[model samples]
Target: MVSDFRKKKLLHVFTSFFDRNGSGSIDKKDFELAIENISKLRGWSSGDAKYVETQSALLKIWEALQSRADSDKDGEISVDEWISMWDEFAKNPSAPLEWQNLYSKFIFNLEDASGDGVIDGEEFSSVYESFGLSKSDALVAFKKMSKGKGQVSWSEFQELWKEYFTTEDVAAPGNFIFGKTSF
Candidate 1:
């Protein structure tokens, strides 16, 4: 079961990223908006390879989320439904679900703009800035997340990603992964 603190963290992600249309639920339209926003942030014009790849990745995420979380089959995932889905995953933290792995990989790839298999401070800040977080906050968060290492490798990011979803420790560096969450 997800604790209150973890639920708060999950809710932050839902509101901040998934519910892009402010429609009170997650649906295909929200993913579409995310694709547009992220592609625009990366300066990937329409028909560009990057744009097409992003479209494919995000749509796959949406499909996975909808199939797993939309319990009512309403073509949208309510906050309660989202929490419920995560609760099941939290029951076995050692085995992450497919969508979780996919989402993490997507985020890592998105943030690793240099294609160097690691995310530097600038790359981290730029991606979060696109999510509407301030660059200063992102840098601070990255510093915490990287433990002053100046960059985060894929293995490190995967651990932080898992910690973000599973740990209730307010002081965990993973808490800052999305940039200065109130929780």
Candidate 2:
């Protein structure tokens, strides 16, 4: 069962990220918008190799999510459907989540603007700012998640990613991975 706290956090993700079109559900259009927004953030113009690659990756992610979460085969994932799929995953945190791993890699790559294999504060803040979060708030989140290390490596990000999905503790730094969430 998904704890109420976990559900709140998941709902935050749905509203803040997944439901990009604000249509009360996640669909292909939402992923399309995400691709556009993220590519724009990276300054990848249409027809650019990077833009095309990102579009492919994001569309794959959308397919995976739709296959797993759109239980009614309605070509959309409602909040209830989204929560239900996550609830199942919550039962076995150790289970491999391929789509999630792919998504995490995508985010990590996006944040690692320098391509130096890590995300520095400036890079992190810039990506979050594209998501409509304030740079100051993103820096605060980066500070907490990085534990004052001044940067985050892929391994550290993976752990934080897992914590964000599995931890019930409100104070967990992973709670701010996507920005500040109302507890």
Candidate 3:
């Protein structure tokens, strides 16, 4: 956990990131911009990192934001709502999730969409449709994830997760845009 002082600093920085306009509040676009900025800084691939746009991971983030921001039927986040969400985050920072396990489970869940622990194209497509991603995304992910010549096994998924998630900056990884920051 971060100290209150650090959390406060994080809050300030995050709010600044979210407050794109001079209105001193966050709208959906501002939040999306913040997500985009994080990807820039973190060197996250479009598929690896999430934005407010539709994607499996993004859906989860948006769900949390909806619970926090979509109050009073405004479909937008007021300053108060933004502060409330910020406070919630300060009080309980999201645990640093392990990406390897996360990626594995993501594929497995897609494979086992029916909850029977089996994978089919139909099931994988369900997860893809949920994220507005194409079935080709899964195919590509699988192709890269697969180590053996023929088919991908669960173990191969882990290797793919590491290689994809742990690229040495975005340039080292494909399909990632790079940004330069000054010291």
**Candidate 2 colliding pairs:** none
Error of model 2, residue 146, in angstroms: 1.0
- What lDDT tens digits, residue by residue, belong to model 2 across residues 29-92? 9999999999899889989999999999999989988888889999999999988977777677
RMSD of each: 1.2, 1.3, 12.9
TM-score, one value per model: 0.95, 0.94, 0.33
Residue 158 Cα positional deviation in candidate 1, in Å, after optimal superposition: 0.7
Q: What do the candidate models score in CA lDDT, each in turn? A: 0.88, 0.86, 0.43
Q: What number of clashing residue pairs does each candidate have, in the order they appear? A: 0, 0, 0
Candidate 1 lDDT: 0.88
lDDT of 1 by residue, 6-96 (tens): 8899898999889999999999999999999998999998799999999999999888888888899999999999898878876777797
In terms of lDDT, which candidate is strongest?
Answer: 1
lDDT, candidate 3, 101-177, per-residue tens? 34246445434545554444455444443433456654444333332133434554344334332333332311110
Supply the global lDDT for candidate 3: 0.43
